[model samples]
Target: MKLIFSIRSYDWIDYAAGLILSESDIYHVMILLKDDDGSMCDCKNFCSQAIYEQRKFDLFNVGKKLGVKKLINLGYDADEIDINKLTSQLQLYLMLSGVNEVYCQYSLPILEILKNICNKLNIKLYFYNIEDRKDEYLMVVGKEIRLSNDIINIKNNLSNLTIGRYTIVVNNETKERFYYIYKE
Candidate 1:
């Protein structure tokens, strides 16, 4: 299965558009790494709280738009960058879930790290960039190509789908807990 693993940001409309327009059977599994610098000052600010809430709300809407099957968050922060922990977690998930293709949105060292991980795990990796958002139908990283249809605005087409929301239940076959779309 294909997995859309995003981090740090909730900009998923472009990814959703690529999948929809291509008619590819790709399941989005957003892995939100909580690397927020939880400073006391930042936490205490009212603006910060409001922005957090807004971000959460936006994430929900984006997930719904993408029909995300699972949203995983690795809680807490580390004092230092623990490559082993990060690699193991990602590898375990990919192995367990049988994910072959990983479309990721991350920056810097993490991007390089993901590349190495995907390479080692024998999985296809696509660097998902919001800047190259709707221009390319398929997420071919580094390729600059305009989408044939200028009239088609992808963001406008994102309508929330109506389906029975399922809680994270253990899959009998895989023995893995899956959280489908959240219920309102």
Candidate 2:
């Protein structure tokens, strides 16, 4: 599966780039919202408890626009950065938004805290690492085959055929194959 980690600062783009590149079904985009102090604030609320609700509302609105499945807070501080505190704060925001997944940018401490919280809340935790290269490719070929009404009639006529795997080919090359395992 593809996963994206959205951080709280643009500076994290480099760090995130080293992990993920380009966007696809498995990997999308990681959005980072920077704090006023140029540090990752997790969401819009960090230090002040009074603004927690407001921050959560703002985050939900932004996340909805971005189509983010989950949101993570990367709290940074000059003196001391508390991963547990940040995780707790983010958990509240996620709960309010009805999001289950929380992510981090290679922060082991933050991941551990998220793990504990997920276990307590019965939410699933996913840690995504950037692969060196994409592994799979899908291709669809159309010109080599043609379908007519006769094929539909044939399919209907085969209603009594025992459910099993069948291979249909125009020539020696296999054009289409299907497995009908559960037909009554």
Candidate 3:
């Protein structure tokens, strides 16, 4: 089974698109929620909190879009960057459920922690850039790409692919100057 570990809600859509293309079972899709800054966050308090209305909507829509309804909310935490708590929770979960692979696109602070966890869990960790959003189809599609699908747009924005511990990158593969994220 493949798992995606996305912390930010904005990143969820891209990961969801990738997960969909990867053909990972929706049953295994879990949102590592509650890297959350508090105990009383916009937890399903959608359309209520103006402070986080947009986030709540995004979280709900993204999960629903990915067919992942279950969430692992680490309830009651004040520290925003609580690496220890996050790692511990993740370890416990992995102890109970062995993982086949995990994909995460994130900045620093959690990188080392995630690497250690993946190593301990003995699972493959794929680290694609935040920009490498929706390109699983591009890897397999023919060169004469002419997609006008309503569900997926062909931004062709993938630049790198990380499998295991290796990062394969594009060095002038395309002449296009800008990368675009497919908007839904």
Candidate that scores best on TM-score:
1
Better of 1 and 2 by TM-score: 1
lDDT value for model 2? 0.39
All models: lDDT?
A: 0.52, 0.39, 0.47
Kindly list the per-residue Cα lDDT of model 3 for residues 1-184, writing each as its tens digit. Answer: 5566665434444434544543546434444443322212213332324423444544455555556545443433334556777788777766676666666656565567778888987877665453444453332111122234533442233211100111123683423122244432
Of 1 and 3, the candidate ranking higher by lDDT = 1
| Model 3: ten consecutive residues of lowest lDDT | 159-168
- Taking all chains together, each candidate's TM-score versus the true structure is 0.58, 0.36, 0.55
Estimate, for each residue in 35-146, the C-alpha lDDT of model 2 and write its tens digit. 3341112232334433333434444543343344454544454346665666667567445545444334544565676667667776555553333224321111111122
Best by the lDDT measure: 1
lDDT for position 159 in model 1? 27
Residue 147 alpha-carbon offset, candidate 1, angstroms: 6.1
Q: Could you tell me the lDDT of residue 33 within candidate 1?
A: 50
